[model samples]
Target: MSPIELNKRQEEILQIVKNNGPITGEQIADRLSLTRATLRPDLAILTMAGFLDARPRVGYFYAGKKSAQALGDTMNNMKVKDFQSMPVVVRESVSVYDAICQMFLEDVGTLFVVDEQSLLVGVLSRKDLLRTSIGRQELNQIPVHIIMTRMPNITTCKKSESLIEVSRRLIEQQIDAVPVVAEEPAGLRVTGRITKTTITRAFLSLSESHEL
Candidate 1:
């Protein structure tokens, strides 16, 4: 069914049901000082929209914010693996100048910094390169490891983790992207990447699916 927005009276009816529910239609009409027939259409719309559930003889009850809660649960259950993109990786020893070039060439806002063994070591962003390049006597001589956010400080997520959790970390930590990694004997190994754009796309897809 197409989404229907509740009117003011409908909202008031919902609030009344929430405050005192399993309430009969007559009781609800009485609360508003209106006849039961006047409230019938509103109650029917709410019940059919899933905002309120009614029983044969028992009465009407609040459905616990079903629409919002259902959307939240759907987003929380979406896995990072389903939305992550291939990571753009550069060695930690790579020069800051070279890292900047790679970032531009890859057209990404952030780059995953890894060790020679392909283990995740750090993360470098455009801001880091710009800040370091401003006053640097020798840009090519500066290693990314010196300016990049190192391990333990870098926020990483696993493929199996929820996109909701990843999105939360991204917002809370104020980072452009997160490296999707797998635990190894030595350290976390980069597998993929999740960016703000990726989250936006995922949300759009979810919205379309729900609409369908």
Candidate 2:
């Protein structure tokens, strides 16, 4: 991994924190004649990338981790299950019409498809349903299995995978989410779900916690 490259201001902030250990972000900003709000993002990056540590009601302190390796180490330490959301799954036998209703009710962009054995079989997306529903009036009669993107074609993640890697795959494939699955004797078993929103929330929570 490459070392975290910082702009002049970030460098200055680090120097300040190093000199005055445990100094508040507000104080660091004051030294640079900037507002705390302007420094929020820099502080978050520094802390998250492992250059610094933040303590609530206290302040920021340098962690002294090697910049080149800290980012990977910090990200890898965050397990998917620690931040994953509960999965919304539907059976392969479910009707396309009913699946649409479930999607609206659940308010999710994707759904995991499972079989009678509760093993993952496929996936359902709004696009899949819309395409299938275009001229079909028998949505009630048509099952999701007929339209779902099946296994091997579907991208999946494990509970033990890191969020960094999972989020990367989500963007690369241009998919909104992926099911967190476990390899069972029969097949892959859906355990949870990870989405772009879920990752956004996780980062937001991390940044918010370290905000001054």
Candidate 3:
């Protein structure tokens, strides 16, 4: 028999599991305004795709750490590289106020902080901005580098890493987002980004499959 393709509804169901997984079928149905019976097929497909795991009482989770292991298995001894292709980045010199504005304009949660050489020096998030704002500090004088998560310990992902691995890091870190990094002549550089939304979409795509 030919393989089944995921339809739009199946994709939606998959997203629910990825975003708020370990959730109950009933909860999923409720979110979609669907009946349990109506959503069964989508759930079943997601289960088949290895996108979700069902628990007896705890409900369906996003498969938690399994995706990371799967990524390792699939890659075969490859290291989890940093995200270099970050979409939004700002200079360490950029003011918190300006950074906040950029974040809002970009509709992203985090921004990479780059040095004069454009090397990744730190990371800033919406939470950081809010915290800084609470103090009412001088945005123009205060550099984002002061409030950003600095280098070497930054949680990042590479484009080559499997989507599953990326998803795992996002969940485990409990952070809003991650920065992509790449090797540059001067040093490691911020490239792009992979966010919860991206992982959520991937999970949904995996879940919305037809029976084999």
Candidate 4:
């Protein structure tokens, strides 16, 4: 089914119902600082549009899976650039131990590996460092480039791409994050990153935007 298009007020109403329902119409109106009369039309539309369900004594409730689907559709329409987080970067020539320290200091699961020109060259995950660190006494002497996932093999997304596509890549690749990049005269330059945490924040923002 085609998703219902909601105006600001309707979205606000749906959000309220999702949070505080099964709540009375009068209560919802009170939260919005509008009279029940003023809110009647919105309530009617939401009920008819299948975004809400009302019970006689219990008040109103969100329409369950349909509401979830609507939120998912909205998220899918949002662009990756709109929600991508700042990337933690390290030079390819940096030692593996130093890179690990940087990752811990920045509190990120992955780090974008870049060249001297700041062009994206590879990607390094915690797993990569862990595998390399085991039984290795020369971690501080080994460059990250030796173990990083190189370009063309690394999953990346452009700023113009949708969040849906980025989320798909995160799941399908079994990776924690994807670098957001732009094509340059020299190579791909890392601008940002989309991670599982970023997606969680996006969901929270979407939910909070509709709150009372």
Winning candidate number (TM-score): 1
lDDT over C-alpha atoms for residue 115 of model 1: 88
After TM-score superposition, what is the CA distance of residue 96 in candidate 3 from its true location, in Å? 0.4
Q: Which stretches of model 3 miss by more than 4 angstroms?
A: 1-3, 7-86, 209-212
- CA lDDT of each candidate? 0.83, 0.82, 0.68, 0.82
In model 3, the worst 10-residue window by lDDT is 76-85
- Superposed model 4: Cα runs more than 4 Å off: 1-73, 210-212
Q: All candidates: CA RMSD in angstroms?
A: 15.8, 9.3, 12.9, 11.6
Residue by residue across 1-212, what tens digits does model 1's lDDT show? Answer: 44545666788999999999999999999999997856654675466446788998999999955453356655665777766788999998889999999998999999999988999999998889889989845989999999999978999999999888998999999999999999989999999999999889776555543453
| Local accuracy of candidate 2 as per-residue lDDT tens digits, 26-117 | 89989999988567656755776678989998999988755444435556766676667778999999999999999999999899999989
Worst 10 residues of 1 by lDDT: 65-74
Model 2 is weakest, by summed lDDT over 10 consecutive residues, at 203-212
Best by lDDT: 1
Q: Which regions of candidate 1 fall more than 4 Å away from where they truly are?
A: 1-69
Instruction: Report the Cα lDDT for candidate 4.
Output: 0.82
Question: Each model's TM-score?
Answer: 0.66, 0.66, 0.60, 0.65
**Per-residue alpha-carbon lDDT of model 4 for 73-143, expressed as tens digits?**
55555677566778899999999999999999999999999999999999999999999999547998899
Write the number of the candidate with greater TM-score, choosing between 3 and 4.
Answer: 4
